[model samples]
Target: MTLTKLQKKFAEGIALGMKQGQAARYAGYSEKSADTQAYNNMKNVEILAFADELIEAQKSMLKRRFSGLASIAVDKTIDILQDVDASPQARLNAAKMILDYAGMEEPKQLNVTADVNQSNPFEGLTTDELRKLIDDG
Candidate 1:
């Protein structure tokens, strides 16, 4: 159902956080009947739905704005990481910040046991042989 012009105005006012009576008055209802008008408007399904739509739109806009700000913040953090004149500690902190924001903080230590009976592939290899092996690989 579509809302009337005054009802649309009242919904807009309500979406902006005005009190019901104030919204009714802002919608051009007489001061003497503003309270009554407000009460009636509040019970209207169409007006309530319109007000909810406005609120959702506002939330979407804020989310987009915050996303842009977050992008700028991440860019600044990356700049700090790349700055040669930044202190070692500052660069380290920036690196950590970026890693944390990217959800890649350091992993916990893991322990592994090797079987003593297993033959070693590179044991007793000459240094030159190892170098050649690495080069070929």
Candidate 2:
């Protein structure tokens, strides 16, 4: 079976992570380490295959009532991105990174706020701090 575009992107992420000796944590499994070294060592084609299934699993999980797993997956994706070395133009890459993780088409608009709303109680917090708060809440 052929890999889709999203599958290709996911496979590339795994390959990059493996090359850097960084473990990819997905669905509570470490893509690195002795237990999962084989998975981490998968080639592009193999990873593409694995990613196809993983994406399907994530979609199914999202359809259920569980609201928290999706956020955990996003956090894991972000951690993976940070562990990998991207080019200097990280902003452009961030958008692609997010879409690739979510296995979705490009969004018409992203609702992210660049600056804090002064009216918000935690408006003074940095983006990093805000992200933590949002994730924790």
Candidate 3:
């Protein structure tokens, strides 16, 4: 969806805020300045685009944080781009290797206690049994 000028401005501000937070750590400047500069530098649409990237990066960063893994996900992502070969065959090979590695790693499992099925009376019934019961009834 296309955003209004105001919406664009808001998104730009948010993007700037995220950038400021990161920049503040490296440069001895206030986070707010980063935000203001980001807003001022880009038009509404560019700001919105940047906002989307920022949100994705934030989500990835959060996932890294909660997983308690020590590696910097951002740095790794950068490394992947830096090492990318321009040739199609080479890139394809790299992609395959990455997919293989990712597939080899186990995904983290979540714990849940609640029994979710409450309303399905015939949930556990076999198809034949259900048909027979329906016919009998």
**Best of the candidates, TM-score:** 1
TM-score of each: 0.53, 0.22, 0.23
Among all windows of 10 consecutive residues in model 2, the one with the lowest summed lDDT is 19-28
Task: For candidate 2, write residues 1-137 as lDDT tens digits.
Answer: 66545444445455344432232332223444523543443555566567566666667767885667778867765765575466546645665779876697775885875875567688689999999988999
lDDT by residue for model 3 over 1-137, one digit each (tens)? 66544444455446556453343323333455755644453454565585688778888888877675434543454455457455666555556555555676446699979867668888899999999998999
Using lDDT as the measure, the top candidate is: 1
Q: How much is the lDDT of residue 89 in candidate 2?
A: 62
Rank the models by TM-score, top first: 1, 3, 2
- Segments in model 2 whose C-alpha atoms lie over 4 Å from true places: 1-20, 24-42, 66-137
Assess candidate 3 and give its TM-score to the true structure. Answer: 0.23
What RMSD does model 3 have? 17.6
| Candidate 1 Cα lDDT to native | 0.94
lDDT of 3 at 30: 46
Error of 3 at 21 (Å): 18
